[model samples]
Target: MRTSSLTGVTPVLTGSYTPDSGGDGPGIAALRLDPTTGHLSYDEVEPLPVSGASFLAAHPSLAVVYSTNETEAGTVSAVTRADDGTLSPLGDPMSSGGANPCHLTVHPGGEWLLTANYGSDTAPGTVAVHRLGADGGLLEPTDLVVHQGSGPVAGRQEGSHAHQVLVDPAGRFVLATDLGADAVFTYRLDTRTGTLERVAVNPMRAGSGPRHLAFSPDGDLVFSADELSSTVTCHRYDAATGVLTALSSVPATTAEDVANQPGGIVASPCGRFVWVTNRGADTVAAFRLAGNTLEPLGEVPAGGAWPRGLALVDGHLLVANQHSGSLAVLRVLDDGSLAQPHPPISAPSVVCALAL
Candidate 1:
C-alpha cells in the first residue's frame, strides 16, 4: 500500500479493461492517487460481468458512468460511481446496432452519449445515440446512422469502420472517425432530442485511417490520429456550420523506425502543447502549437511497451501501456519535455483512464 500524500482533497482515478478470461466478465477498476507525491494505490476492482466492454466515459456532473462492449452485437453499459469511487451497475445495457462498438462520447452537458460501432464486413458500421438521464443512466436509443466507404487499404478499408466518436466543445456537433473508410463525418447534434443529422463528411488521405480525435481548448482546431499511416492530421474547425477543413498533417514516425503507431491524443489544458502516443515504438511525441500549426517538440520513451492510452492529471502525464501492463508516470516540464520517469506500476490490460 502507498501512503497518501493528499492534503485537503482525496483523489481517485478510474480505469477500464477486458480480462483474459473470455466471458461476459469485463470489469472496471478504481485506484486512489496522492496529489502531492503522485503515489497510486489500488482501491477497488468492480466486476461488471458484461461481455466485450473495451472503453469507458465518466459523467462530468452526475456520478454515472458509461462503457462500450466491442462485438458484433455491441452494447453500452451504464453504471453509477459512488463517493468512494466504487461503481454500481445501473440500467440494462443498450445495443450499438452494429458490430465492434469501441469508442464512446458524452455530451458536454452530460445529457447525451454516443457510440462508434466499427462494424465487420458482414455487419457494416454505425453510430448509436442515446439519451443520458439525470441519474446518468441511458434512457433510450434516440438515433442510429450507418456508414459507407472504402479506402486504399484493400483489406482494412474494404468497408466502413467507425473508429471513434467525439462531441465538439460547443456541444453542437458530433465527430466520428472511420478508420477503414478513411473519413471523418461531422453531424449536427440535437441535444434536446438526442438526434444527429449528417452535416458534412470529410474524406481523409487515401489510407490515413483516422482513429481518434481531440479538440483544442478554444475550439478552433481539431487533431486526429491516423493509425495506419502513422500521422496526425490537423483541421480548422467551424463550430457554426459543423465543418472541418484540412490544415496539415504531421508525421508521427521518425526516420529510424515507427513503433506501435499513434493512438490517443490530448491537447494540454493550457493549449500550449499536444501529446500523442506511439504504442509499438514505446514513445510519446510532444508538439508545440503555434497558431494552427504543429511543431514537433521532442519524443520521450514512454517507459513501457504499447502505450495505448494517456491522461494529463495535475500536470503529470500518466500513460497506460496496454501490452506491457504498466502505467508510465512522467512530469511535464514547462518547455514541453519530460522529467525522469518514476517507476511504473503494473496494471491489468489498461485501455483507458479517467481522473476523478
Candidate 2:
C-alpha cells in the first residue's frame, strides 16, 4: 500500500515504531481522534528511518513516546511530541544490547523504564532495565538480565523469547512473559535505582507460552494470555511476595481449533469485562468476570483480520487489526459483547493502540 499524506486535523504528536517492511521504516503519524464520533483522522505522517520499531510506549506525563526495535542491534528511541503532533528526536537512541525488544513499560513515578527483549533467530532473549530522565528519555542501560528455558513444544521453544513486560497498577511489581520458558518472571520495582531484582517466578503450563499479561483494577488478580494454548490464565496475586497462584485457566479460544486462540488480554477499566483477541479466527472475545470465574459472551467480529492490539478508551474499544491493516472502534454492550461504532478505519500494519 502506498503511504498516505496525513491531513485534516491538528495532531498533538506523532508516534512510530522502528521496524518498517521493505527497508522502509514505519511512519511516525500525527493523529486527531474525535471523542464524540470515535473517529481517528491523521494529521501528518513522517518516515522514521530506524528499522524494527515494533512497540511505542508513551511516558507517564505524555511528554515523549519510546519505540522498541525488535532487531539484532536492539535499541530504543525517545521522541518528543510537538504541539502539532510532529515528533522531534530527543537525543541519541540507546542500544538495548539485547535482541528483539518487543515491549516496554514506564515507571509510575516516571523515573525508570523497562524493555523486554524477545531476541532473534541467533540471539537469546533477555530483559534490559534502564532509568528514565526527568525530561522523558531513556537513561543508558545499567542493568540487563537474560532468560533461559525451553517449553515442551520443540518447534516453538528453540530458545527463550521475552514476549512482554508489564508493571502492576500499584507499581510494586514488574512481570515479564517468557514465551519459550513458559513462565512469568516477577520482580520488585526499585524506583530509586531503576533495577529489577527477582522476587518470584511462576511457571505456566507446559506448552502454554505465556505471551502477555494484564492486571485487574484492584490489583488483586492477574490475567495472562497464552498464545500457543489459546488460553487465558487467572492468578491470585500476592502483592507482598509477588507470587501468583493459579486460580483458573480459561479458554480464550473455542474448540480445539487453533484459529480461536487470542493474542491479547486486558480488563475493562470498570472491571466488569475482559477482552482477548483470537488472531486466527479474526475475532475479539469478550467475557464477563464474576469473582474468579469468567463466562464467555460470544465473539465480536473485529471488522478486520488478525486483531492484535486493543485498548479501552472512554466508552469505546479501539482495535488494531494487523492483517486487514485497519483500526476499529467498538462499544461494549451491556451483555459484554462488542458492536461496531462505524466502519473499520485504515492503518498500515497496525499492531498496538494506546489512548492518551
Candidate 3:
C-alpha cells in the first residue's frame, strides 16, 4: 500500500447536514491544512439549495463530488472540482428513490453510484443505484431495493432504516447497514446493469443498531459500529462468496453507561488499528487488531461533541463534530494515539469531512 505523504497536503472539504428548521450552515465548507504545522484554516463555503447536504463522496478518478441531500424528499447532486479545490454545481439534482437518503458511495469502477435511504413516514428504507455518465453526472436510478423487518428496539427500530451502503474493496459485493433492523445486508452487484441482488443478511445483536462498517486492509475482516449499543463488532468476510460471519462484539466506550452512541468507524491506513467515535461520550476509541479480534487500546476526547465522521489524511485524524459544529485535527501518533496540535476549527453542523 502507498502511504500518503504529508509534505504537500492542503485542501479538505466538509459537508454540513443542517436541517432547514434550525442552524444557518452552508452546505459545503472548504478548508486549507498546513501540513508542516498541522493547523487548519477556513477558506470558503458553498450554499446548496437543498436543505440537508449531509454526506459527500468523491469520484474515484474524476474531479467530481457527490452529495446526499438528506431531507424528507431526498435527492443527490454532483459538483465539479476546480484546480484550486473549489467546486461548482455539475447539473440538477436527481431523485434518490426514497426519503432522507443519508449515505452514498461511488463504485470503484466509477460506473455506478449507490445510496442508502433512511426512510420516513411515507416511504420505506431502500438502497438505490444510479448509473454515472462519462461526465460524472448522475442518471436516473436503475434499481431500488426496499428492505423489510425491524429490530427489538422501540421508537428507533420501528422500521427498516438503511443508513449506509458500501461496495466491498474487491468490488464484488455491496454491504448495506440497516440501523433499524440491526443487520448488515449483503448484495451481489451487477456492475453491467447497476442493480443489486440480496445474497445474505448478517444479523447483529438485537437493538445493536449497526450504522457504518469498515473493511480491513486485506479485505478478510469487517468491523461495524453499532450506534445504539455503542459497540464494535467483528466479522469474517469471504470476498469471493459475499458472506459475513460475526466473530465478536466489543464496547466502544469504557464507561458503564449505555447512552454512548457510536458514529463512524475506520481502520488505520497501515491496518494496525481500528478507531470508532462515541457521541454521548464525546471520545474516539482505539482498538488494536489481535488475530481477527480487537483489543481496546483506549479512548480520547473527540475535542467536541458528537463526532459524526472521521477521515485520515496527511498523518492527521480529522473529525467532524456535529452538535458542536467544528472540525478537529489531531496528529496520529505511531502508537495510534491522537494529540491535538491546534484548537478545533469552526464549521456549522459539520457532519462529514472529505480529504482531497
TM-scores, all models, native as reference: 0.91, 0.90, 0.94
- In the range 1-356, model 3's lDDT, one tens digit per residue, is 11122446577778886657244568877777776778888765454444577888989888888998888878888987676556688888999989998899999988899999999755678999999999999987899999887988878888999999998888889999999988889998898888889999888889999999999988989999999888899899999878888899889899775479999898986788898888989888888988878899888888799899988778887888899988888778888877753689988888888877
**What digit string (tens of lDDT, one per residue) describes model 1 on residues 29-134?**
6666555666666665564555555677778777776888766668888877666555678988888767888889788878888999999887777898988877
Better of 1 and 3 by TM-score: 3
- Evaluated against the true structure, the overall lDDT of model 2 is 0.74
List runs of model 2 lying over 4 Å from the truth: 1-25, 45-50, 255-261
What local lDDT score does residue 225 receive in model 2, on the 0 to 100 scale? 83
Worst 10 residues of 2 by lDDT: 1-10
Ranking of models by TM-score: 3, 1, 2
Q: Cα deviation in Å at residue 355, candidate 1?
A: 0.8
The number of the candidate with the highest TM-score is: 3
Using lDDT, give the best candidate's number.
3
Off by more than 4 A, model 1: 1-16, 20-26, 44-50
How many residue pairs in model 1 have overlapping backbones?
4
